[model samples]
Structure formats: C-alpha cells, structure tokens
Target: MSDTTGGLLTIAALIILLAAVHKPFGDYMAHVFTSAKHWRVEKRIYRVLGVNADSEQSARSYTVSVLGFSLISIVVLFLILVGQKALPFDRGLPGMPWDMSLNTAVSFVTNTNWQSYSGESTLGFAAQAGGLVIQNFLSAAVGIAVAIALVRGFVRSRSGELGNFWVDLVRGTIRILLPLSFVAAILLVSQGVIQNFGDHTVHALTGGTQVIPGGPVASQESIKELGTNGGGFFNGNSSHPFENGTPFSNLIELFLLLVIPVSLTRTLGTMVGSRKQGYAILGAMTFMFGAALAVVTWAEAGMHSQAAQLAGGSMEGKETQFGSWASSLFATATTGTSTGAINSAHDSLSPTGGGTVLVNMMLGEVAPGGVGAGIYGILVMAVVTVFIAGLMVGRTPEILGKKIGTKEMTYVALYTLSVPAIILVGIGLAIALHGTPGYMNNPGSHGFSEVVYAFTSAANNNGSAFAGITVTSHFFQISLAAAMLLGRFIPIALVLGLAGSLAKQGKVPVTAGTLPTHTPLFASLLVGVILLVTGLTFFPALALGPLAEALS
Candidate 1:
C-alpha cells in the first residue's frame, strides 16, 4: 500500500481497537470509582487528611478545597526544590536557582514541564521523589477532575452542578491514577529502569569520576507518561537509561502515554449513554495521530539515509538506542497528548517531522490530547464542528441528547480559539522584536521557527521545545511566561463555563432522523473537520518553519 494508504489504515485499526475496548474500560472505571468496594480506601484517605469524605459541600466550595490542597502541595514542592542541596539523599549541585525553582514548580503543577535547568546535576533524590513525582500525580489529578466535571455536565439529570471538584480530584488520583502508575512503575523497574534512595554513584573510569544518576526514576517515569505530564526525572528525559532502560520499556512508555487518553473516550461514551459517539471521537483522534506518526517516521527515516548527505544534522541530537523510528514515534505520542517528553531533540528532527509536531499541538493536542485536557479540548471542537455541520444541513445540533445552543457554542469557540490567539500573538511579538541578538542560535528562518514553536508549545501547554533555540533571555522569559499562563488557564476556565451551561440544559430525546454519530461516516467527518480547522489556522506559520527547512 502507498504510505498515505498505510497511514490511513493504521489510524483505522487504532480507532477500531479503541472502539472495541470502550465498553470494557468504561465499565472498569465506573466500577472502580462508584462501587462500594472502594469506599474504605476513600474513607482512610479522608481520615488521614482530617476532612469529611462525605461532606455536603457546594461544588464551588469543593473546588476551593481542591485548589487549597494543590496550593499547599505546590508550596511543599517549592521548598523541597529550594532546599535540595541540604536535604537527605542529596547528590545535588547546590539547590535550584530561585527563578528556576519557581519555573519548575509552575511547570509541573500546570503539567507544562518546561525545564530551565539540567536535571542530572541539580536535583537530589528527595526532590525528585517528593517534589516532581508528587506534582506528577497532582497535576494529572487536576486534569482528570476537570475532565470528569465536563463529563458530569453531559451525564447529569436536571442538575446544574457538575460534581464536586475535591471528590473527583481524590477519586481520580487515589483510585484510578495511583493504582495504574504503581503497576506501570513496577514494570518499568523490572525492565531495569532505576529506583533508589541513595545519592549519585561515582565510579572511577579513565581517572575521572563519572556521576551515576540514581533516584525513584521508574516510579516517576510511569506517571510521567500515564499522567501525560512528561517532565523527566533527568535532563535527558526519556532518552536517559535510568528513566527508560530498554526498547521494550520504551514501547511500554509510549503505549502508557496513549492508553488513558484513548480509554477516556470510552468513559465519555459511557457517561453520555452512547457507545457509538465515543467511537466517533476516538476514530477521529486515531486518524490524526496515525497520520502524524507516519509523516514523522518517514521523514526521520528519509533523513537517516547515508545516501542523502544533507549538511544539516537530522540525527545528531537523537539517542542511538532508540533510533529514528522510536524517536519519531515518541515525538508523535508526546504531541498527540500534550506530553512534552523528548527522546530526540525536536529541533534536530527533519523539517517534516518538526512540522508534524507543530501541527499536532496546533490541532489543540486533542488527537487524544493532554491528560483530561485532551479529551475535553477535542470535544469542544467536536461541538463546534457538529454545530456547523448542523447549520449546513439545516437542523438543530444535538450531541448525545445535549442541545448545541449559543451558550454552548460560545464557550466552545472561545476555548478552541484561545490558544491559537495566544500563540500567534506571542510569535508575532517575538519576531517583531527580532529576538535578542545573541539568542538567535540557528539564525534567520529556522531561528524564527524556534521562537514560534517555543511560544506555541508553551502557550498551548505542550512543553516540547525546538531545542536549537536559546530561550534564556529576558524577552523569551517574559513572552513564554505569558504564553504559559494564558495557555494553561483559558481552556480550563472555558471548559468550566461550558460544563456549567451544559449542566443547565435538559436532555433532548433522539428522533428517527437524529444523526448516528458512532458510524464511520461521522467519524470521517469529525477527522476532516479537525484537520480543516487546524490546517487553515496553522498552515502558514508551519510553511515558514519546517516547510522552509525541508524544501531548502
């Protein structure tokens, strides 16, 4: 088959797989969360925390409580980073500089994971385990809670409230994420990914002390992918041997990043009482993800050919153990879900691969996007697309019995457009200022694309970087900080707004002429709509970057 045909088929197969697994996984989640069997676990946690597990608190009050706990965690994490040098199990190169510590804390908490410091030299074992790993769970829990709130909006009967945030947060973390992460972490450890309590090991080799990294790497590695928070315990991220030891482990990491996001669509389908609609969304996500994967893999492979002595380094910054295909696949997986871990430097990717990553992020990371964020983000676009399609067909738009009205569409459109607006404006400002003269590492067009990609990644909360760019300057700091803030919060606020509006609506009954969303037809349409919308918005910016690099 042609590459395009193969790509299409791969995507189709993935969708079929997701569709087939939806009911089973959805039932599993329901059983895990709502069943009486889990109540004792919940009670124990509440008892330790000294709070009422069954409090009749309002949703707003519960949200505040969740936020309060999160804030306390952040403070604790910050202190841990600041005091790493003096902490037990310290193998640290002093503690993190104050600015870097602040950035790291914010990065992980927001699930951005935009590291400004080298990981190996700076952090100790305690900081790695307590600070970063804990945030991995908390940040992912936040995403899951937000997603569940949105799901509740559709699932409720005449209720204007979309579940309590505190309850959802606790259940999502303690019940779903913790168990899966433990199993995955143990598997990683068995595969030779490291877990330890000691300082960095020093071995005498060639008369130089080689500092061997050690920590609870395997533990964090699991949630780093599973939670969709791709912050590396080491600076090398997934490329580090301690974090991802073998090819088998690498493949497992890739699938773990994908599984939850893929499975959540099933949860969505279950909550809405229609298996087919969930399948439709999964089909669309799989199509986009597979297409990007093929493009990236082919581009990386083409660049690897010795026959093409291209001057620019395509594989220079990549890890050898995981060659072109592995790097390409990981990059594809990372972008697909807003997880920003890199086994290969994105800047070193063939322009085509780089371009694909950019487009994936620009697509709202909703091809089974960021943790809970990805699903809700894609669903927003789905709502907009359905609304538009309904207008064209001259009918009122309804999804799983929920009416698509002005209020719903307004929130969806705002949420959809917010990141792009931030990205474009940030890029425009960076270029207009000409960047710092010394910070133009690649110079000319590639340099410009680096700045664009960084801002886009930060603003979109997708933390993978075009590594060639020097973003340490005051200008980049200010610009990217702005992007991160806007990127992280706007969609969340809009999702909450959408949930509120959705919760107030009464479910409409399906009619004979109601669209069957679960079929291949709607799935195809959803994929096309996502592409059309993202393509129109980002094609120009992308052409200037990777397209230019590839053609040149």
Candidate 2:
C-alpha cells in the first residue's frame, strides 16, 4: 500500500477497534466501581491490605487515601530501587543513585513513567517486573478511580460520599485493567515480544559479538501502553527491536495505548446516564486526534529537516520497519493519549511534527487522555466551556442537569491553571540551567524547544522526552519529579473536589435556557475552548522554540 494509505488504515483500524469495545469496556468499568457485589478475591485482598472495602468516603477522605497510598508506594519502590544490589532476587544490578531512584519512583507511581535512566542496564528484573510493573497497574487503577469519582459527582446529588477509594481501586485493577492487560500481553508474546527473566543472549556478527537483551517484556509491555505508563525496558524504548520486533507489534502497541483512554469516554457517557454526552466528548477528542495525525503525516511527508533532506524523507529517527506513516501515527497516538511510548525519536521529528506533539500535551491531553486522566481533564474543560458560553448567553451554567456555580468554577479554575503554571515555571528554571555544562546537546531555538518540551511533558504527565536536553542532574530530577507529582495529583484533587461540590447539588430540570452539552455545537465549543486556552498559554513558548526553528 501507499504511505498515506497505509497511515490512514493504521489509524482508522485503531479507532474502529476502539469503537467495538467502547460500550462493553466502558459499561464494564461503570459496573466495576459502582457494583455493590464484591469478588471473593477482592474481599481477601482488602482484608490483607487492612482496607475496609465497604466503608464509603467523602471526597477529602478519598483524596487522602489516594495520596497516602501513592506516597507509600513511592517509598516502597524507592527502597526497592536504591537497595536493588542487596536484594535476594535482584542479584546483579547496582542500586540506583539517590535522586534517580526518587524521580523514577515518583514517575511510575504518578502514572507519568518518566525515565531519565535507561531500564536495560540500570534496573534488575525484580525492580522492573516487580516494582515498576506493580505501579503500572496501581497507578492506572488510581487514575480510573478518580475519574469514576468525578462521574459520581455529576450523577449523584445530596451525597457527601463519592465511594470507597480502596474498593474503587481494587475493582479497577482486578475488573478492568488486569484482564485487558493479560490478554494484550499474550497477544504481544505471540507476536514476538519477549517474556523471560534471563540474561542477554550473545551472538557473533561480522564485525563483532552482539548481546541482545531479554526480559519479561511482553507482560510489562502490555500494561505499559494499556495503563498509559510509558517506561521502556530498553534504552531505545519501543524503537528497540526486542521491545517491538515487527510492524504488527508496533500496530498492537498503538492500539493498546489508545484503547482505554478512548473507551473511557463511553464509560463516562454510560455512568452519567447520557451516552450522547459521552459522544459529545468523544467527538471533541476525535477531532483533535485526527487533526494531529493529519498534520504530523503531512509534516513527516514534507521532510522539512536538514537531516530529512539528506535522508530523502522523515526517516532520520523513525523505525524503518514501521516506516514514516507508522512513525507519524505512533507520534500522534503516544502524545494524544498521554502514552509516551515512542516507536521513534520525538526529538528528531521534523519541526512541524515535533511541535504538534508539544501542542498535543499542552492541550491538557484531553483528546482521549491517559486512561482516567483524559476523561476528567476534558470534562473539567467542558465545565469551562459551558461557563464561557453561559457568560456570552447570560444564562446560568448547567451541565448534565446541574447548575455550575462559583464553587464548581473555582475548582475548574484551579485545575485549568495548575498545568500552565507548572510548565512555565519549569521552563524558566530549565532555561536558566542551560548555562551548565552538558545541559543541552543542541544550541539555539531548537535547544530552547527541548527545555520547554521537557517541562511540558512532565507537567502534563507525558513521559516522552524531546531528547537533546540532559535531564540527569539533581535540578531536573527534583524539579521534574515535583512537576510530575503535582501535575498528576493536584488536578486529580481539584476534580475530586469539583465532584464533591457537584454531588451535593440536586439535578435541575432541563429548560430552554439549559446549555445543550450533548450537541455537536457544544462539542465544537469544547474543542475551541481547549485550543484557545492552550494556544494563549503556550504560544509564546512555541514561537520561541519549534515555530522559531521552523521559520529559521
């Protein structure tokens, strides 16, 4: 098939498969967190963890549990990493350095999965499969729990209790994430992703001997994308042959990363008792996803870079087995879903393609966001959209039959402002750090883009680095760790708070004055609001970085 045709088919197939499972998966998730019935295994696990599964919690209580659990998880993982060399099972690898361990622990637990250090050489099997993989499941489960809590806010009234955090967390992992990941893992293994705990296999080449790495990659790979945690087992990430051996592997990885985030829209629609409203959000997400893919494809095809000019295409940093079409698709999908698993080097993307990735993260990643993150992120933006429209029409802001008041708006305001605040501050600080030796590999406007992109990825909880910027220092470690943690849980806290306030109000009767959030017009409005807000927020940075590089 032709390049463009192949690209269209790859992307189209993903959307189609997602459509097939959206209702079933979404409904299953809805049933999971809300069901009164508990599995016998769930009961046992809860007892073991000292969790009272039946006890409901206020939003504050729920938030506390999330924070407490995450904090503890971070500490546990850090201990595992820092003490790896002495551990019984992880016998060979050296313990992680202090700051890297802390940063990595925070990264995985927050669902950011940002890796400053390569996984192949640095971490042992115990830390990789046991510690990091555990967080992959837990962190994703935590995200969905928060999203469902927000849904509860819209659906329930006159209730302070959202749900039990432990119950929600357990149900999400056991009921939804684990099952899906299990099946995806098997599929990946069959398609040549490794599933072992052995040492690297050695082979002799014409020039010299080569040592190929092996691990429990298929199982971790499945959840890495499926959970929207993008930490790679190898330094080359998905671009590495062993991590993703073939075009088919690339295709399936793309599907896995996007499936949950895309379907969560349907889950939202189902839980809120309005599938149309879910469709409205999906419509907005699809628009942005499609637009990014198209522009990226065009940019890659244009081969705008000096390197691309020599290579005769956008093949400089892309995996040739997947080709430019697949590379562009992967770029858009990874950025679009908060899945930072790169099949190619994002830093090598032509100026336009790389900037689009930045723009995707900057847009709050709401277009089919990372697992639960995308749904709530977009929904919060929806609140902003309706509020703006309400002002223009001089009507009370109401969504899903509830009045959006000052209290709800305040939560939305905080949620909206948190990301840009973190990103801009981190960028300024990173630029200052630029004067240090080895801080940047590329100097000039493109170098500035690398700094901006690093903070953008961290603050947005996107783990994909733009490369060419050294982030191994104490400054980047602490600062980026802070950005990932705050960027993740702070918005989650605000969403839960909004959910709490929204839960307390009784649903209003629909009227002529009520804004039609389910309609196409509202979907368009949501998209417009997101674009306008992100454009205004990040435009200056863009002009100075990618845009400047492109113009030059």
Worst 10 residues of 1 by lDDT: 304-313
Question: Candidate 2, overall lDDT?
Answer: 0.89
| Clash list (residue pairs), candidate 2 | 369-374
What's the lDDT for residue 382 in model 2?
Answer: 95
Taking the tens digit of each residue's C-alpha lDDT, what string does model 1 give over 290-409? 799888888876644322247443566677677666787789989889899888888767667788888888888988898888888877877887787798888999876789998888
lDDT of 2 by residue, 1-552 (tens): 787788778777877888898889878877887789999999999989988888889999999999999999999999999999876557378899999999999999989888999988898888898899999999999999999999999999899989999998888888888998999888888778898877765657666667667788988999999999898988788888878888888888988898888888888888888999999999999999989988888888876888889878888788778888888888888889887889989998998999999999999988789989999999999999999999999999999988999999999999999999999999887777536436877778888888888999998888999876888999999999999999998999999999999988998999877889999999999999999999999999999999999888
Count backbone clashes in candidate 1: 2
lDDT of 1: 0.77
Error of 1 at 138 (Å): 1.2
Count of clashing residue pairs in every prediction = 2, 1
- Model 1 scores a TM of 0.91
